[model samples]
Target: MPLPEDAPELSPALDPWEGLEPSGGQGSGGGRPSKPGPGLHLVATPIGNARDITLRALDVLAAADLIVCEDTRVTSRLMQIHGLHRPLMPYHDHNAAKVRPEILARLAQGAVIALVSDAGTPLVSDPGYRLVVDAVAAGIKVTTLPGASSVLAALTLAALPTDRFLFAGFLPPKSAARRETLGELAPVRATLVFLESAQRLADMLADAAAVLGPRPAAVARELTKLFEEVRRETLDSLAAHYAAAGPPKGEVVVVIGPPTEAAGASEAEIDAALQAELAHAGPSAAAAKVAAAFNLPRRQVYARAMALKAAAP
Candidate 1:
């Protein structure tokens, strides 16, 4: 069985799941396991370390009537390592429309189907959301067996503000569109997280530096594995580092810090800003918008707005 070009450069047998007790699947002799409930079970597999899987996830995978995945071979290899010889079928973006109805039919028939991505949790960046939506509409129960998430893993490693964060998914592949999108999110006051391909990482970092300015940022690569690395630096330095080093291997996530007090504009600048927002908004509302943007006092922004309005044509 040949691995796909996109298949992870990992052997499932390595770094065996530490907390999981080896249990029954096909020949797994932990003992006869209790049957998982019928309907759809969304299972989360490890992102890097193979042993990050949970005991309950193992039980569901073992008892599942069928295991649906984005890539059959990828999931098969993982199951083989864990000694869970469950049946597997493909359910990816390309073929999801055609395959989803069949999956729903299986659930309707009381099949305990487990849906998993090639790695990590399903439905985050994957195409599992549509299936989940349809399954719920068809009155099929959908239960998620929560475990191993790259988003959470990267956020924790990044050492940024955990109080608030945004997972922005992926940027557009084209440079122009990516920059424009980044510009739209420039005013956001929380840490920004993005999932980027290893090959495009350097370019993405460069664009973030150009559009988002020099906020502190972190690049987490090959997380939870032997070579796991978390590089925390300002956006400009990260851009420069990756540009010089070329793209590193494996999965990548970028976490960027929010704007600092310097984001506040001067009085003249605030007046110019209010000119645009004031025409469409009343003074109080307009000042509130500017105040939030710069974390300034609303009274000051309101006074500025009033002065700007009285002097206007």
Candidate 2:
């Protein structure tokens, strides 16, 4: 989420609103563009810090015909703090089906609408995707204004690999479902991020260890708040801690590091590497190279090598 250094300057607080506007028009956006376009603006609000709101986001909110949010009270508080009052309408999961048509009608009439989640970015663990899909299908312009996100926040301090990471979101609550989901992600080969209820933290971590083996993991809670905490340990140890100490308070994000090559490489990759070595070398020599390359056990590699050779012409 970075830009070229040569890009025209805007407020540094404008994390995701680059070039959308000249940083002015209404609210804190001190100047005015000669013209303003009407479309759906997907705005990102703060995860915790109220000061994290961007100047451009405030301007969009001020200029929009109406603001769609999960809760009017939440948006009203933000509006009060910024001294920018705009019309608010509820568009959460329960009423989205009934209210989406009304929102479309307004968009068709050239209304500039701003969509926001209660916290963080919109459509993250929310029901906003369908609206975006429908808007695009209806030829309505839709864009996003990114800002603070808990997912990124947890990732930064979790001390895990970010080169390749997967945001797996939340698993099912039941033990069997959670274990099944964990088994499915057992070989993701990247950091696995999940949002879990505070009450379910212990059971979830326990399931992760049993299904995911001894990979390094971190549990982050109460992020950006007074009592923020991030605990890093192996899957088994983290599970034992949470199980013994009970669930920690507030929102939680679990980040699990990817497995090492011995455990991470797929069966197909192991076999391919083995076959290439087996083509010219005898079974013992071929198995040694393949085992070293993938950091796998010699016995396993040698067994696979024998199987491949026996089936060969």
User: Which numbered prediction scores highest in TM-score against the true structure?
Assistant: 2
Q: 1-313, model 1: which lDDT tens digit per residue?
A: 3466898887777876768775554377767778988999999999988899987799899889999999999999899999889889899989999989999999999999999998899999999999999999999999999999999999887756666678899999999999999999998877799999988988998899898777668899899999999987778899899989998988998988765453545444666678889989988899899888878666546655765676579
Model 1: residue 1 alpha-carbon error in angstroms: 45
**Quick one: best lDDT, which candidate?**
1
The positional error of residue 304 in candidate 2, measured at the CA in angstroms, is 31
Q: Give me the displacement of residue 132 in model 1, in angstroms.
A: 0.3
RMSD to the hidden true structure, all candidates: 15.2, 11.6
Model 2 over residues 1-313: C-alpha lDDT tens digits?
Answer: 4456798877778768555545654454556743246889999988777888987787788878999999999988988888989899999989999999999889989999999998889998988898999999999999888897889999877766666789988999999999999999988777799999988998899899889877667899888888889987778899899889987888899988776567567655777888999889998899899889888666556756775676579
The lDDT for every candidate, in the order shown, is 0.85, 0.84
lDDT of 1 at 285: 92
Which 10 residues in a row give candidate 1 its minimum summed lDDT?
259-268
* Regions more than 4 Å wrong, model 1: 1-32, 262-313
Off by over 4 Å in 2: 1-22, 25-36, 263-313
Let me know the TM-score candidate 1 reaches against the reference structure: 0.75
Q: List the residue pairs that clash in candidate 1.
A: 17-51, 24-28
